[model samples]
Target: MEQYAQDTPKWKAELFDWLKSFLIIGSATAVIYLFIMAPYVVQGRSMETTLHDGERVIVNKAIYYLDDPQPGDIVIIHPDASGENWIKRVVAVAGDTVEAKNDQLYVNGQPLQEDYLNENRLKSEAAGVVLTADFGPVTVEEGSVFVMGDNRNNSMDSRVIGPVQLDHVVGRAEFVYWPFNAIRMPK
Candidate 1:
């Protein structure tokens, strides 16, 4: 009976040690994730062909703090100070001109090769719609970057929201981790 009693205390001590270790490890992981990287879910089809709706992606939050977001990198944008975060691809940096004419896109007066888009969708240009309308030769201001979605005609991006200030960018999204088979680095 005494031997049985000693065994119970030994088992309890082992369980207590495990719980403490678990709590410490869990807390550390949460802190690291919160400060360094974050997971985001695609809320819309704005980034289609590159990132789809309902996909899970990891954002490298510490990157922009060390370097500016270059054109071609997909970034999470904070539309307004208090608005919900949105995603878009950086199309042009400061001093660059972005324009659309005849359902074609140009950056710095050179045609942008948008191989990611389906031409049929970009052809939907109703009159007076600025999305694919002829405009600009407008130079982007300092400290801001122009952004657009991969699904050109369907996304509400810089063409609609104006330039995204570098300060308003959250992070660069580099990997998709969800849906198992769909997991891969976005081009």
Candidate 2:
């Protein structure tokens, strides 16, 4: 009877240890999913064709925490005026000269070949020229970025709001995880 009683206590202790281990693992997973690896829902069609409204994308919050934003990367940024977040593609990096003339985009005097843009969505007017037109030869200030939308006609990006400050960039959007077939890395 004494031996049986000792075994019962040992069994209970093992059960408790197993429960604790399971709880710890579950909590860690929740933290990583919510804070690090979760997918964000698209609120607008500014990135249409590339990212659609109501679709979901997985952004790597960990990547931008260490590296600088790169050209051709789609990014999420914060706006001070409206306190809203925006997602757009990085067209011109720091120190690149960006111009839109005759509806063609040029960076550093070299025309950018934007195959991702829809011809119907291209704006005829030079929207970025508002300030650059008045000021002449807009050089993207160091540590700033010029962004645009794939749906060029409809997006309110750096063209309207001016170049985004480097610090305003929140994260690089790495992939779209929702809508099943659209699950792929963003260019």
- How big is the positional error of residue 175 in model 2, measured in Å on the Cα after superposition? 1.5
Summarize candidate 1's per-residue lDDT along 78-117 as a digit string, tens digits: 9897868898999899999998887678999898876766
| Tens digits of per-residue lDDT for model 2, 32-82 | 774566567877878877888987887766676677787788888775667
Cα error, candidate 1, residue 81 (Å)? 2.4
lDDT of 2 at 61: 62
Candidate 1 vs. truth: CA RMSD?
4.8
Alpha-carbon RMSD to native, per candidate: 4.8, 5.2
Candidate 2, residue 21: the lDDT equals 100
Judge candidate 1 against the unseen true structure and give its global Cα lDDT, from 0 to 1: 0.83
Clash pairs for candidate 2:
none
Off by over 4 Å in 2: 1-36, 81-83, 118-137
What lDDT does the true structure give each of the candidates? 0.83, 0.75
